[model samples]
Target: MNKQPQGNIFHTPEMFRVFDQTKGHKSTLWAVVDNDNCPLALLLPVHVTLMNGLLRQLTTRAIAYGSILSVPGTAGQTALALLLQTYKREAKGTALFTELRNLSDLGQPQTLLNDNGFAYEGHLNYLINLNRPAEELLQSIGQRTRKKIRKGLRDGFVQMSEATTLAELEHWYEILQKTYSNAQVPLADRSLFMAAFNELYPKGMAKFLLAQVNGVTAACSIELPYKNVIYGWYGGSDRAYSDYLPNEMLIWHILEWGANNGYGIYDFGGAGKPDEEYGVRDFKAKFGGDLVNFGRNVYVHNPSLLKLSKRGYEVYRRFFIR
Candidate 1:
């Protein structure tokens, strides 16, 4: 699957192991192979069950990051169609919905996806090219963002470094937990990140970076690096240090590190739906990356249940999130 152009970290064996070992996450793989047993197409979706008790069933959903990985042309499309059919049959009633997050252009296979019951939705993402000179990359940044980064560095208010120990990773995770808790959003358990650190960090498939202010961790980000692309997976900051622009510095540090290390692209994970008003999207846009609408394909097994689940989530957020 790594040989395929669209293959991403989420579709790899390493990530599958991360999800499988993580609490509340169930990883599944479906593939189409040739007579000689060569893989023609592959799909790896992880069912994430959040919250507890009855809410877990409602919030459980599958996410296929980077969508279907397949060979080019008609044969590949045929294989993908077959794989989708088999996967849909097995996935029915397993979750509220299965979302295929497309990282690259699916091209003609999108029709096959629609035919297989997945409906398309418009989504957006930012991609910063890292295969350029460090100066060129810096010059491309939006003027305002560049100023904030410069001011933070010039004043020595924030320091950026990669987390090198388990404790450091945990510290970073604490910031992420607080950020999600404040936003009333569901975050995966710490076991997921611990697994990634244990399994992927040593292999250079993962990186944990920290931004510190006055020797205290103020912001953090976890990046999944596969092939030539560094995917920005999770990140958050201590809002108390917002004046120091820790988030901006953290992102700049990642970009600089990637550009200096021969990485080709930094995928800004996601930018929310195009039709929605997302503050994070506006924040990400200031970093000077090309915005792309790769979109997403969703197959909801039970629409009425999904609606109920949405309402249940609102209650969960209002009462149980803290």
Candidate 2:
């Protein structure tokens, strides 16, 4: 929920201005208050959706990310207390996979979310503190992967940022489509990303990376810069880049930039689970990332409601996602 913008200082630049306008179908955000009810952090939800608000669409639950309820210094506790108060007082509804991503305070959020009746399917992420030398960091990769990194350098790949133009984002859209199509996973909404990129490009708190060779785009990634930490949010690469190790080099450049820019952590982001994404897990670990079970400690308010609705989701997943 948002009131008219009053130019609060605690607002995170990472949140897009479009989110400030509240144009999407269904979105949740954090709000801060002072002793006199002053507003603080009203951030974008970790999850994005278009729900009917009316229970007409209220038939399931979902996991969400990036749902941050922050209040300058002491209001974090106040914000959580407010969330519990509102959740306890609100009417019941249904949802499908309301995920809360980018929660740094995993313990507090899991407690608040569980108390509010949300279940954490899991938290997916690996964070690498970019506090070490680049060469020292590079040495940590698996032998074969390390060799691949060296080969990538030999193949004439170059790493650069802001080379990622509108054309590249569109190309990435195509690459991502191909990736999802090949993997049979759902593609994220394109307009949502377009809006996101348009809002956060260049000046604000966003950065894009491009791996190029002979002036051709090979691998690319995007990072969300906030509070001196850059999140390795999204990326894709052509098959050739994998052979050349441009992906590794792209990250190498990114990490270098982060270090110089005063950033402390390079969140390689989530890799699902080790069992499901062993390759990804191994790949990120090569960069000195550590696994963090991000969203496991939850407190559920209505266990019966969640249990009762599982069958609907079971059938829906089998029919649609499966």
TM-score of each: 0.97, 0.73
Error of 1 at 68 (Å): 1.0
User: Which parts of model 2 are misplaced by more than 4 Å?
Assistant: 1-25, 30-32, 39-47, 50-64, 70-79, 107-113, 120-124, 158-164, 213-215, 274-278, 296-322
Please, what are the lDDT tens digits per residue for candidate 2 over residues 1-322?
A: 2332212211344344434343333344545566787654343433233333552243433323355454434466557667555643442343433445544654454565666665566656777777767666567656776677767666655756563467767766676566555554545566645755776665555666777766777777777776656778667777755655667778877887777777777888777753465566666767667677664333333466556546545664456552
lDDT of 1 by residue, 1-322 (tens): 6577787888888889999999999999889999988888888889888865867778899988768888898878889989998888887888999999999888988888999889999999999999999879988999988977877778987987888898888888899999999888888899999999988999999989899999998999999888999999999989998988889988998899899999999999999999899999999999899999989999998899899988988887899898
TM-score of 1: 0.97
Q: Which stretches of candidate 1 lie over 4 Å from their true place?
A: 51-56
Give the winner by lDDT.
1
Candidate lDDT values, in order? 0.89, 0.57
